[model samples]
Target: MKILLVDDDPNILELVNIHLSQAGYEVIKATNGLEALAFLDEELPDLAVVDVMMPKMDGYTLTKRLRAEADIPVLLLTAKGELEDKEKGFLAGSDDYVVKPFEPKELLFRINAILRRYDKAVDTIIEVGPMKINRQSYEVSIGKKVLLPPLKEFELLSLLSSKPNHVFERDFLIERVWGYDYEGDEQTLNVHIKRLRDKLPEEVKIVTVRGVGYKLEVDAP
Candidate 1:
């Protein structure tokens, strides 16, 4: 998952970035709301964590502007803890709120909850060549027929399909599809990759980079 962290406090931004990165999430940093908007122009993140107070744009205004442009989830991070403050955050289109001076673990927990809620509502359908991968439904289909891929295979396919031709390093795929603490070796990943290849469409190929990693090569539509 990718998270955009917007805060005026350099210390807080660094701290949050470090924690989220350690937890296996990609973190993009912005010093203020205007900077965050500039980052958004380049690419949209999976989620945003905005500070309530800032120089150019406060969290509330940023949340409102973010909602106007994207459907991604926004979480307000602030020092305010009152009922009205939280209500204001929600009114500005924030999906969740976390007060400052909070435990890093608690913030991570809230982020996970917000993402789960978003996954339920967001249409996470990726179309590549002739295949469609519906992430929420955990269904992979070509035309009208669904491919019953095993759990690990499904995750592997989804990860590869998510980025189309982007190459994923061997170790990176294992860490993502399996777990960060996975003890298995590369052979396990190769076995799963072979199975995925057998089940996938002929036009879709999991190409191996000579010494780098693997990437999905989809035939033109």
Candidate 2:
């Protein structure tokens, strides 16, 4: 998914960007709330990560304005971790809150949880070939054997298996799996595809179409 990250600190921006990108989310950066607002005119992201304190405009006001215009989820990221600060964040229409100096894994987990709740409310267990993917639990297994894959790999596999044998172009796959805001090159896609191939069962194969795209083709039982 695409996430707008609004922060004044260049260090914080770079840190969050690296972690979020590694976790498979496309990130758009804004130095402050005003810059973030300008970005809204161009394209709306799936979610926004706003810092509580910023120049030009604070996160609360940005979140309020965002709510006034769009229905996207907003996450407040700042050093304020007190109850009152959290309450204020919610009052500003933020869907979640994360304190600064937080664990990258924790941030990623929260992002996934919020997106799962916002995007797909219902739980679904997708069974294709030998793999069973529990959407709600974010677990993938083949009968008794469980497969633990990185975020990008899991997303790529889930998407390809969603529609078996359907030829999905490279651009389409990147857009759906990585979001339009993705800044990574095509090499990232190739790397994730390789990881998924190595992890998935032999029967579950991702077939490549020369100069076209990819499809999930399952071997016969």
Candidate 3:
């Protein structure tokens, strides 16, 4: 698997990149959020490891952008150990958050946990009103009728439908489905949501939360 890593500190970038690369993942490195965006198109990684502090563009902004586009797993490296900071990371769009000066082994564990959740992700198909999400196969159906999801479509649908009323910040959706964090562009979320809407039952709705996240609401099936 490939992993996109963005950090301003050359030392941290090189250290983490080397460790992850040695663990058998192809690591793509970027110095800032903008550079990360440029790499997104050229190097599609299975996961992303990002540092919260950076120059030119911060990790939070970068993560937000990536989450908007795809459902990749995101692991955050935070220099601040404050609880609020970690909470903010989750709110912004992170699958897992680790404090800076973290143990490399612990980082590996968090990354693997997200990756290993495949079994959990696919174990069930959730139904809410007209929306049906097949967790095991990553398939989704609308109105109890078969609505075959294209390859990428299922991931997007599952991310939203799994949390009926919970507003999923765009970044969270991106990381959950794309296997990386956001880079700060919410338009990517808009596009996939629009695509998912096409297959959803007319009665079910996926609404935007203004400046926050997205929510999927449904009625009695």
Which candidate number maximizes TM-score? Answer: 1
- How close to the true structure is residue 4 of candidate 1, measured as C-alpha lDDT? 92
- Write the number of the candidate with greater lDDT, choosing between 2 and 3: 2
lDDT of each: 0.85, 0.83, 0.75
lDDT of 2 by residue, 1-221 (tens): 57999999999999999988765567999999888888888888989988989988999999998888877889999999999999999998999999988987677767766775664553377789888987666679997998767777777877787678887778767766676567889998998888888888899998999887899999989
Task: Please give, for residues 1-221, the per-residue lDDT of candidate 1 as tens digits.
Answer: 78999999999999999888776578999999999988877888999999999997889999999888876799999999999999999999999999999888678777867865675566588888889988877899998889767778987888788787888778667766665557878999899988888878889999998776899999876
- As for TM-score, the candidate ahead, 2 or 3, is 2
- Overall local distance difference test of candidate 1: 0.85
Model 1 clash tally? 0
* Between candidates 1 and 2, the lDDT winner: 1
Instruction: Report clashes for each candidate as comma-separated counts.
Output: 0, 0, 25
Off by over 4 Å in 1: 19-28, 38-43, 80-84, 101-124, 135-137, 143-145, 150-152, 168-194, 207-214, 219-221
Q: What TM-score, to 2 decimals, does candidate 3 have?
A: 0.55
Tell me the deviation in Å of residue 16 in model 1.
2.8
**lDDT for model 2, on a 0 to 1 scale?**
0.83
